[model samples]
Target: MRCFEHPSQKRLLRFISPIACLISFMVTDLVTAEEAWLTRSQQLLNTLQGQAKPAWLENNPHQLEARQQVLELFNTSKPLTDLKFGTEQSPMGKNGQPLKMLFISFSLGETTLKGIFEEASGRDDVLLVFRGPKPSQKLPALMGDLKRLLKGIDPVPNIVIDPTRFQRWSVASVPDIVVEQDRKSRLHVRGVSSLSWLDEQIKAGKQGDLGTLGDVGEIAEIDLLEEIKRRMAAIDWKQKQQQAIARFWAQQKFEDLPTAQADRDRSVDLTITAPRDLSAPNGQRIIRAGQTVNPLDKMPFGLCLMVFDATVPAQVELIQHHSCQDKKARVLYLASSMPRQDGWDSLKRLETTLQAPVYLLTPDVRIRFQLQHVPAIVEQVGKHLVVHERKVRASQGAPS
Candidate 1:
């Protein structure tokens, strides 16, 4: 009883202390000379709170100044009279102010919606309008955007209403955005955007000089067919075998050893066999159909098989055999040691960086390669192997 009562008393005291402190601080603060200046500043902001004041001006001075610097060209726009935006009313634009409101919507399951919202939150002037079919489930996304925007800056005033408020705002897909000029407002994006892009839009609206934003390497989206091709291209067992055959043929004194086509003109072809038991003691693993003959007892090509605990030979060959069997040119396999989702992210980074074809491999799907690191690069150059290992400074040559 004592412990329970003590906890209840502590909870009550904790809840009351902050309110008491706040009241005491408010009383003291209201009496000081500095408080008088703060009061005057607040009053000034209130006076500037005309219907057409820039969105940044709705906040305090610090926020206003930060927005002005970030927004570049500040314009004045009227506050939205009708908070609701959807099919019912026409979209509103500023008759003369700084930032514009953009209403956005999405179909569903758009991962990039948050990134665009995050970009918008950095500016005080721009108002982001979001509406959804299901208001309860959808409103959280908008609230989250607003909350993030309000952080680290004076809270920019925004009105959130249901989907039935304004008209003329359009959404292309799940998480689409519509830009509005609410009298004093400017334009905001209705699609995927970045912070720099948002800044550029603000500058563009103000007729200020703005430049393009650069990209970092990462795969944005993966095409299934292209991924298959990439994995196939990584195989070198056939290519290497062909090279060895060509070199042997060139050295032969007799021209009777099937002198048919030139090595350079002929392409390397290969067939990969699944796990098969070998007649030898080494116990076969995943082996190519035309592998080198074992020097010891004469039977057939030394059969290799992929095993669990026993030593698995030719892990690289196994990967090439399985993953790239049907793939063609312009193919890629993005492997990461971090994790599967992280591997996909690395794939995205590569897509962004290379701006080319690439695919991400799922984690836990253990490939035979000794990839115990991050940022490892593997590529097959015809019959030769090329690997670029990312280091602290720069990547070194392909792992020997």
Candidate 2:
């Protein structure tokens, strides 16, 4: 009031006041465009609204894929699809794995394994390799086999359970010796467990398969490499694929909600304070930091989101009859829960039953809508979201 009493100061204040208001309004509009939850939700839904993932991704988890690819490494018939082989360098295998290895299996027995381990001791380049896990591909079996074989041997040999090496050298028998340099086999001796014999043969300028100098004993156990290949060939990947997909879906973190009980209605405020300056698509400054925004003023909602638990038949039927289904606005179906037994199958079935594409409800959409129950319709009414939680138990026999 005292400052307004001065005429010159009043004129200056009048000059700056309009500019400040203009800046504040611009900032508010910018934030509204940037931080509006509805705008973000619509964009997300539009991208994934009706899109179904490929069969491989839907049914395959990383853990199972990892195990399968490793198994594929042992199959010599294929070109080694897994990434266990080195592609370059003279002596260095890719990812710093050893190039020279003694291909021995648990069939070598305790005494022969002890001898090989002692011979390979203090040798960095010569790594003891197993064509496959002992007894079976299970980790516990492999660990038990190692414990049984290397009980008394001091300084456990540098060991690697890489079946790729056996495939790389086309090893048909255990206790095979191989030295690779520059992606080419330099020396390979089948039916020999002695790393010392390999070194002596190399010293004598022996290259290629040179183990036939004298009689070599036959492997006692079934060729584990061949057995691994046979087992791999016998796998029912198609059946396991469905199980893998189910596991993947079961591991997902969905914001599970209870069945809608009573008829109710609610509102969601679209107001958001800008975290920073936001720009429009045309590169114009819209909202600046700290400005409160409501995006409905500029961008109206033209899409209706119908959320329900797909596992509930009554709720699904209610959604089918919801008024929004006949609205001019684009309707998106989002399921809170679906059958985890065969997620892809259930998704397909839901889409078939509704004659429309269905998607899984995301946590962000749930939080933004402030959803507490399923079988709900979310749409914009005027400037804020209006969630219509309809009661269908009386006629529709919705789940309690």
Candidate 3:
């Protein structure tokens, strides 16, 4: 028996048939393309394996020569001078007192450095020594480590790197606190110790005797009668001098002063129109449209102000792009507000990279320009200033 198909079923079949055929054709084409690609890849790999390898790839003469030169340079380095004890005049006190020298090494840990710093705090009499060269590459790292260790109380110990001083003290190892009162007397304390302990050892040494005081009886007495006679002679001379001065003033005639001249051009005062206040409650300021500023008759050339939030990384990239675009313009980078240490660090890095000066947005500039959002560029156009605020996209690497 013959069956009639529904019109809806016919339409469904018509749609499904083409889609199924297209998918089947796509799968067959994909499988054929993949097989061809695999065959080509295998042939290329086999050809590469059969080829001879380069001799330089196994043994590079240029790389070996560079390594040999580096080794030779390192071997030729100068040897450090041997450490020994010597006497030097102390810079801390007067009367040629010998300084108590304490030699230290930078290799010491932060905890030991901190302990030594606490011991030497408020005591300028003792000398802290460093054996290494002054202002070395490693010195800044050492200083940073010390700063982190001694939080709040920034105690910069007096560090001496004089080879002569280090040798005179005979510093063998790190954390050696040596107290030298004189050439003959020296107390060496190895490792980290308290300042009070060093001070006690210094006090235990023999004290020098105080010298004889001057006698008051040796002073000569002043003569009162001779002093009175000298005063009377001076008073008589002053009266004669005053009488001669009065006669000299009476002989001279007084002349009238010359009248000052006034120019008509500068007589009229130049009036300056007050700027409109557009500061919002949320610390944002919006300048009104068609508002013209008439502070000066003519606007200065090539003055551009770039305002941005330094905390935003995307805004930083935008500022860098604009800086490169406007080479002739005097671009001043102003942040929305003053940033903390980390923000300031990022701002400083941006400044160094862009080679431009970055300043915090003051209240005066905020109100005057009426800046609302940042990543904004303000520049002088004809008689008025034009402000352009650019939209910043959220960066994937930026902190939430």
lDDT of 3 by residue, 1-400 (tens): 1123333224323423322233233223222332332343233334433343322222233334445533432322111111111122223533446455555554554566567766655455766655432232343353455456545443344444444454565544555555545463355655534567556656887233212222111101112223334444444333443343343234422121111122111111112332554444465543333444343233232447777766666767776776423455566666664344344345447667767556555544554555666767776555456666666555423322
**Candidate of highest lDDT:** 2
Specify the poorest-scoring 10-residue window by lDDT in model 2.
1-10
Query: Per the 3 Å backbone cut-off, how many clashing residue pairs does candidate 1 have?
Result: 62
Residue-pair clashes per prediction, in order, are: 62, 3, 5
- For model 2, residues 105-183, the per-residue Cα lDDT tens digits are 6676777787887776555566676665545356445556666666655545566556556666777677677777767
Off by over 4 Å in 1: 1-95, 105-113, 133-159, 162-166, 172-179, 182-190, 201-400
lDDT of 1: 0.32
Query: Taking the tens digit of each residue's C-alpha lDDT, what string does model 1 give over 167-189?
Result: 34323232233343443213423
Superposition error at 69 for model 2 (Å): 10
Tell me the TM-score of model 3: 0.26
Best prediction by TM-score: 2
For candidate 3, which ten residues in a row score worst on lDDT? 77-86
